[model samples]
Target: MQIIEQQIKTKLSSSAKFYGYIPDVSQEIDPAAERPSVLICPGGGYVMTSDREAEPVALNFVAAGFNAFVLRYSIAPARYPVALLEVASAMKLIRKNSAAWHVDPKRVIIAGFSAGGHLAANFATSWDRDLVTEYGYHADEIQPNGLFLGYSVITSGKYAHVDSFKNLLGDRYGEPELMSKVSLEKQVTKSTPPAFIWHTVSDDTVPVENSLLFAEALEAHQISFELHLFPKGGHGLSLGTSATAIKSNGYGLEPTVSAWRDLFVAWVQNNI
Candidate 1:
């Protein structure tokens, strides 16, 4: 296996970083294999990126026969398009080195949790816009083939995770129109990629409706999607197992919710 770390700089900020976990090919095996990749974004309510959702999640996907990446994207102090642009930069880098990384550029998926989910979903739905082009990337260059959102922050409205929006917009948080514009449910379009989304129905922090709203939008647009609403659990349950559990709080360990990782891998196998 190869571990790669690169600084991801964009016009907005230079604080973001990218980490890749790629399996080394065997000479007697599939040396020329090009595998699918998942770029993960850990959720932090746009304040900070969670360690629980970073490398552990990436390695699990790597173990499941796919190259995986973790994006420590810019957070609160960085604001809005800064994180979005950093995500685009990471995508551009992944595609640029697809050959060397043994990655199938066409099979790239973006996965995120909480606020990171909003960033991933935003890029999935808005990658074709001129904003990305303005940042020196062709819309197609930053496109994601699939989306995997875990208890994400999708809306800026009633179901919105208020602090995530406040942190993302900063001064613009006061602007109702701008706030509404960042509401991902309103951003979905026919061009958006297929998605596999999951959220626990009892999550009070970010709310289950955030995922529901986005899935509804995907369905309304006739886009392909698979949504799973777990009967119970709270927000920010990375793997929902002891592997990602917070030692002091024991916050992440939930046997039932831990199944999301396997389900996601299967979804990729059958869909993406």
Candidate 2:
């Protein structure tokens, strides 16, 4: 396996980082193999990127036979399009190096946890917008073939994760137009990719409605999606297993929710 790390600099923030876990293929194996990839954005309510959702999640995907990349996107104090653009940059980088990296560009997917899910969804729905095109990336260059969201923040209205929006929009938090724009459920379109989303109904932090709203919109648009609402667990559970448990806190561990990873891998195989 090959490990790659690089600082991803964009017009808005220079501190964002990109980490890639690419498996090394040999002639003894399948020399012409080109693997599907997952670009992950770890959530932190737009304040920080959670370590629990970074490498561990990537390693799991790598173990599942997919190349994985993690984007520690810029958070708080850096508003709106900054992190979004950084995501675009990461996608652009991935596709730009797809051949050399042995990646099947058509099978590239974007996965995010919590607020990072918002970023991934935003990019999924708004990839053709002027913001990304203005950033010098063609829509196709940054398009994700599929979306995988984990306990995501998907709205800017009633069920919104207030802090995530506050940090994302900064002073523009309450600006109705901007808020409505970031209310990703309303942003879904025919162009948006199919999605595999999971959230625990017991989550009070971001609420399961966020995922419901996005799924509803996807349905309304006639887009394909698979949503799982677990009966137990809280927000930011990451893998919802001991591996993602924080310190002595086992609240993140939910045996039922841990099945999401395997379900997502199956979804990728069947859907993406």
Candidate 3:
């Protein structure tokens, strides 16, 4: 295994970071083999990136036959479009180095939790627009083949996770028009990538409605998607396993919920 960390070059230099977990040449028999990749965006409601969701999630993806990356994208004090732009830059860099890393650029997936989920969904729905074009990248260059969202923030309304959107909009938080603009559920189109979204109905932080709302939009657009609503559990349940549990006490661990990982791998096998 090889680990490579680098500062993602952006229009404005910032603290945003990108890390890749790739297989070394010796690990694979075929030098020309290209594996599907998953780029993870750990959620911190835009204030910071969570440690629980970063590497552990990447390790699981690696164990599941993927070259993985963790994106610690720009957070608060960095407003709207900044993190989005950073995501675009990360995709470009990954694709740029795809060959050397033995990654399949066309099969790259973006997975995020909480606010990061909002960002991933936003990228999926918004990538084909001027947001990426201004950076000299064609939409396809940065477009993800699929989205894996975990307990994500999908709305900007009453059920919204207030702090997440507040940190995202910054000074523009009160702008009703802008709030609706970034309310991702309303933004989904036929062009949106296929998605695998899961949320626990017991989650009070971001609410399960966020996922349901987005799923409805996907259905309206006739886009392919797989939605899972676990009857139990709460928000921020990274893997629903001890590996990503908040403490050794098994904080977020739940047997049934942990099965989401296997389900995700199966979905990837059939889709990617």
Candidate 4:
């Protein structure tokens, strides 16, 4: 899909600071038509986004008949809620201008892997209702049609990166209540968006338990979801790009961590 380059530097919660635009992509099949959209959050453990996070995934979204935006959210030297705010704002802007971009405000999805996965879950679960009540924003203002957590971190208790929490909250993590509130697992409700999740069993960095716990919560709530756990790839093996992806060309994405990309595409297409 051919796209125009748009770099929009938007405001953070502080409003005084500016987070870079993080390149975004748009496609109008017809000059006067709308399509599904996706907001891509890249992973870097709160520091940087991997190449795989920013490029390949964004391209795949585009090829799948959707408008995709790769959010180069602010990192470490910056803060946590900052990245969260940037993503929320980006979503709001996308929705507000959905008509111009030919996008279906109701079909917008958020996807991320690893740390990016963490934020994706947080924004979908944490920011959804609070951003509405606190800011007087309508449900239309900030909403995600669905969630795609690729080897993500949804719970903040056991498998979280303590250092990342420190960088994002400074002194906030000490507030156990606040931490619990932000933990994605605690926020699941009968109303949480439908989610499609995948992670490897061998993952050690963030742990597959993050996906397990979140998937469990979704099941309990009866929300629609699909989980794929490969046998042996470790953490960050997004869609089988791990040493396993190199070997089998896919990490159970198909079966034994194989053809996952295709599996995800098939699911997304049928659902959307």
- On the 0 to 100 scale, the lDDT of residue 136 in model 3 is 65
TM-score of each: 0.98, 0.98, 0.96, 0.82
Q: What tens-digit string does per-residue lDDT give for candidate 2 at 203-255? A: 98999999999999999999999999999887888887788888775668778
Model 4: per-residue lDDT, tens digit, 166-213?
Answer: 656675666888788667887888767888888888787778888999
Candidate 4: minimum summed lDDT over ten consecutive residues — where?
14-23
lDDT of each: 0.91, 0.92, 0.88, 0.71
What lDDT is reached at residue 188 by model 4?
87
Point out the worst 10-residue segment of candidate 2 by lDDT: 128-137
Q: Output the TM-score of candidate 4.
A: 0.82
RMSD to native for every prediction?
A: 1.0, 1.0, 1.4, 4.6
Which lDDT tens digits does candidate 3 get at residues 124-182? 88888856556666776788899999999989986899999999998899798899879
- Model 1 — TM-score against the truth? 0.98
**Model 2 TM:** 0.98
Worst 10 residues of 1 by lDDT: 128-137
Clashes of 3: 0
2 or 4: which has the higher TM-score?
2
Residue 210 C-alpha lDDT in model 1:
92
